[model samples]
Target: MSFINYATREIQLKIVYYGCGLCGKTTNLQVIHEMLADESKGKLTSLATNQDRTLFFDFMPLVAEAIKGFSTKFQMYTVPGQVMYNLTRRLVLKGVDGVVFTADSQWDKMEENVESFNNLIENLSLQGDSIDKVPYVIQYNKMDLPSVAPVNYLEFLLNNRGVRHPSIIASAKTGEGVLETLNLVTRLVLNNFIKTQTGRSPAEKKNLVLM
Candidate 1:
């Protein structure tokens, strides 16, 4: 659900990054935070363990494009990638307007990728929300790794949801495909919001691509 502040003419939406530990969820945010202008983005805050892996979430708020005279602000977050932090993950997923599923591309991480994706679906269902109903994108991260699996195999493992989502191949360390993934998901979130507010058919939604 979006938070609309009528007095301020602002709309706040949440977008979460989810995946197994070391899948580059944190990398995505860190890269994005570095790329964004200080005027456009808020503090990039994270709660992590001594080793620096995400323990709770990474949160950053940014002002995006406007919608119908309302300022569009996005609350970006990343849930802890550890399976033991499922409770924290569920809490971060509450009222998410969009999601970015960052899958580790290394062949050895395939199983964890699939498991984490399933965890995402289960967590969403526990909140009375379905994956089909949410705006999300898949990011095959760590593509620069020599041991990475092929994109097709990775797609089969994570995107077999019957409804294919926009997926990106990225090397978070290299800053490749990070913003593209973000832009696509934000576009989906904005389109979903517009559709619900105006009752527009999928095809009728405007193509408002974010840079």
Candidate 2:
């Protein structure tokens, strides 16, 4: 988790980007890092194989403006997408507060996307967390490609698995929907953190919606 200590307030959160190989997880990070104001971000560390390939993980810390007296900090990370890097992927997911699953939209990669998503769920379970309990978002990446899957088809597949997480259509290369996805997941995670820390169960919070 990332921590922020400024005077009387403190906040911490960890968000991880997960997806299949070449699904643009790293590209998302690169774009965010470049887009943030210099004062709002720190050096990005990319630990790669052979110093040229992003084979392990990439970490970047961002300090967002204070919100209602609390400073929010995000420790964003990207997991290696290769199946052989399963151990590395699990390690990066440790202590994650939020997840952004970037799914490749290509028709040929449909099965791979499904498998990788299930793997993420299984890994979360092993870490004592479930997909249903975590603040997660989905990014249907590569939307600019002509051969990409239909957005409705993707949403239907996700909903079939009992996941109601918010999904966004994104093209990392063009900076479309990246910040929107990030903002949505960040808001969800922070709001959930506040509720839980204040001893409010998620179900209780939902019930109060009618009041």
Name the best candidate (by lDDT): 1
lDDT of 1 at 174: 97
- In candidate 2, the residue pairs with backbone N, CA or C atoms under 3 Å apart (3 or more residues apart, or in different chains) clash, namely none
Per-residue lDDT of model 2, residues 68-151, tens digit only? 688677888999988889998999899999999999999998888888999999999999988887888999999999998798
How many clashing residue pairs, candidate 2?
0
Q: Compared with the true structure, what per-residue lDDT tens digits does model 1 show for residues 15-127? A: 99999988999889999999989988999998999999898899999887657688899999999998899999999999999999999999999889989999999999999
TM-score of each: 0.95, 0.89
Q: Which stretches of candidate 2 lie over 4 Å from their true place?
A: 1-8, 201-211
What lDDT score is found at residue 125 in candidate 1? 96
* Predicted model with the maximum TM-score: 1
Every candidate's lDDT? 0.92, 0.86
Tell me the deviation in Å of residue 117 in model 1: 0.3
Error of 2 at 19 (Å): 0.8
